[model samples]
Target: MGRPPCCDKVGVKKGPWTPEEDIILVSYIQEHGPGNWRSVPTNTGLLRCSKSCRLRWTNYLRPGIKRGNFTPHEEGMIIHLQALLGNRWAAIASYLPQRTDNDIKNYWNTHLKKRMKKFQTALDSSLVSNSSSSSQLLSKSQNDMNSTSLRSCSTYASSTENISKLLEGWMKASPKATTLKKDQEKEKPSNENTNVVGTASSQFTQTKVEEGECGVISHEELENFFSFENLNSMAWEKSSTDSTPQGSLSSLNDRFGTMTEVKERSSNRPAYCFSDKWILDEESGQVEDLMDLSLDCCSAPIF
Candidate 1:
């Protein structure tokens, strides 16, 4: 179906409103107020059509009609509201108390739409970059975890193997010593002087072996090994002392020293050396370990 005409054709002028028509329309509306657009032109003696007079008043001469360019904030609000409400310019205009739908619609078409497109593009780019960064961090974390697990397994296996070798050496040496003792006993009567010297030599050899296997690790040396724990305890003590002004510095130092000694005795020592027999030589494993180390170093604080 064809669209209906805006106004009746009989004895009504159309098109652009003149300056005189504007003054007449503005004056008439100001004096009598607005209602029936069809009778406004005739009652007010305006040569212009009723639709034209209404348009002039509503679009331009109406009270609270905001002129000039829209602000950035207003543009943002228009774009956002437009996204929610679509092309319902009249409804959108109602929210912006001082602006007309005609003004709003023009601004949206000429300026607001382009600004919104730019905003959307920037938002999409930021989201993509953030997503990529998050994925990289997650992958790095997983790699570090895997490396830690492998290192633990390797250390455990090496320790077990070293213990086993030590036990086997002890077992072999015990039987040989027992056989030598029995032989020495049989020969003791035939040469009493030789037996005395032989016994002393054997005792010295056994002492040397025991000393070699279990190195002389002093209490002071053990304490130094747990220096990190001592440092941590000292920090804690300092923090507590700061809170309590009455706390004695000497007492705090003594407590820290005592805790350090206790930690040294309790802490499990790392193996002196991982047996070469138990170390893996796989290139893939080495690469993974290097990657994990890089990630750890990056994440760790320098201090």
Candidate 2:
């Protein structure tokens, strides 16, 4: 169907309004206060249609109209408000106060639209670059940590190995160290059984507090022995159950998995390690020792 005409076309003048027509329309609106478009031209003695007169007055001839190029601030406002309200130019115009809906709509089409396209393109490119840089930084950090951990692990392994060799040499040299000392009395010779752990001789750093009894280990001996012994037991226990490279890798992954899981479940986890009675390590039959610092160090401070 042919669309109905916007106005009666018989006696109406269409297209760009003249200065005289602008004066007439302005004069009529100022006198009557605008509305009733269909009769404005008739009442004002203008030769334009009601629609043209309305458009002219609303778009151009209205009082307090600020015509010409839009300011940068105005253009920005249009783009921002447009994202929320879209092409409801009349609604957008209401906020600007001095701007008209038709004028704003034309400015958008002629100028801001093209500028926005370029602006959006630059914004997207910047976002992509930021995303790529973030990924690279994360990957680099992980690689650096892996390299550090491997280095520290190798150093620890070397230290423990040297301690092991030293321990074996000391043991072989002291076979007679576990000897039974005889207790002598004035009346009769008595034999009392006493088993000493070791009697590292004069070359081996030992001291006896009293006659016929072994003294406790020195601070130096305990420190050196505990350092290697504790770590050795932990590594051995983990490796014994793990059995293969794949199992070890899986266990490492599980450690991280458990950490993230605990972080996500912060409400359920204990505030302090000492507060918890037991912490089960993945499907294990026996509870791990509290002194196993490896588990707690990794588990806490995840957040």
Candidate 3:
């Protein structure tokens, strides 16, 4: 057998610690900064085992612990970091200053894991909704383009004299026109009311097309159709018509844009967010997967 248990079943106490025990442990730690647990009970005149004394100091009596409920953003960071790092609780705790690994581990088991699962479910639903909306928009645009193309072809087929010339010119120009149209479609938003649609359209045209193409009525027409100024004016008109204050769409867009950028960067590189090697599997004793993804090691707590 493996040597014998340290604390045998005799007068040794366990369970909820008493006030007297708390006071003794706190007093001992305050006076001497917790080096060896084996000597703690003997030196401090406490009846409890050295293991109990050490546990009390590490979990509760330590200074600078911000106890109580965690904020939503902090919870979010913890969940994200945990997924990347695994169960390396001490490492995870280091990122959250003043939080103990034991506390974090308990929180994860009791609360955060469930909350993260719910959040992930909601996120999946949102992604599905967005994808469905995008498909609907693309279908609508395709139908409209097919109808327009049919009308154009019929009109060209009617003219006898320039029929051959028109067909040759159209065949040559269609590919370029199709490319421009695809670019415009990609740039345009399903929600024409948003500032992004206009701004994105203008930028897309300016950067993707040459000066000559930019001058084309199709490009100019698209720009005018998707202009942010026009959308803002429309929003103001609607608000004025309704006798309500025009809600600031610009502010919402600004905040959303920043969040989107940060999310993109985080997804591209997870190492930046982790404080230590996250545990992937406790049973298997596996570490967090670290690929080529660039992590921001500067923000991580030193081991």
State each model's C-alpha RMSD to the native.
Answer: 43.9, 40.1, 32.0
Q: Comparing candidate 2 with candidate 3, which one achieves the higher lDDT? A: 3
**True-structure lDDT of candidate 2:** 0.42
Clashing pairs in 2: none
Candidate 3: residue 288 Cα off by (Å): 23
Per-candidate TM-scores read 0.39, 0.41, 0.41
Steric clash count of candidate 2: 0
Q: Deviation in angstroms for 127 in model 1?
A: 5.9
For this target, which candidate reaches the highest TM-score against the unseen true structure?
3
In model 3, the runs with Cα more than 4 Å from the true position are 1-4, 123-303
Indicate the worst ten consecutive residues by lDDT in candidate 3: 294-303
Candidate 1: worst-modelled 10 consecutive residues by lDDT: 273-282
Sort every candidate by TM-score, greatest first. 3, 2, 1
Candidate 2 C-alpha error for residue 265, in Å = 40
List the global CA lDDT of all models: 0.44, 0.42, 0.42
**Candidates in descending lDDT order:** 1, 3, 2
Score candidate 3 by lDDT: 0.42
Off by over 4 Å in 1: 1-3, 7-12, 121-303
Write down the TM-score for model 2: 0.41
Candidate 2 per-residue C-alpha lDDT over 1-303 given as tens digits, one digit per residue, 9 for 90 to 100? 798786656777776655566667765765565579988978988888788888776665543444544554455445433532346576556435456787778776655554444333443454566443433433443343344323322233343334334433443454331221111112111112101111111101111111111122233543442242433333333223322323322332343333344344343322212101011111121112322332343221100
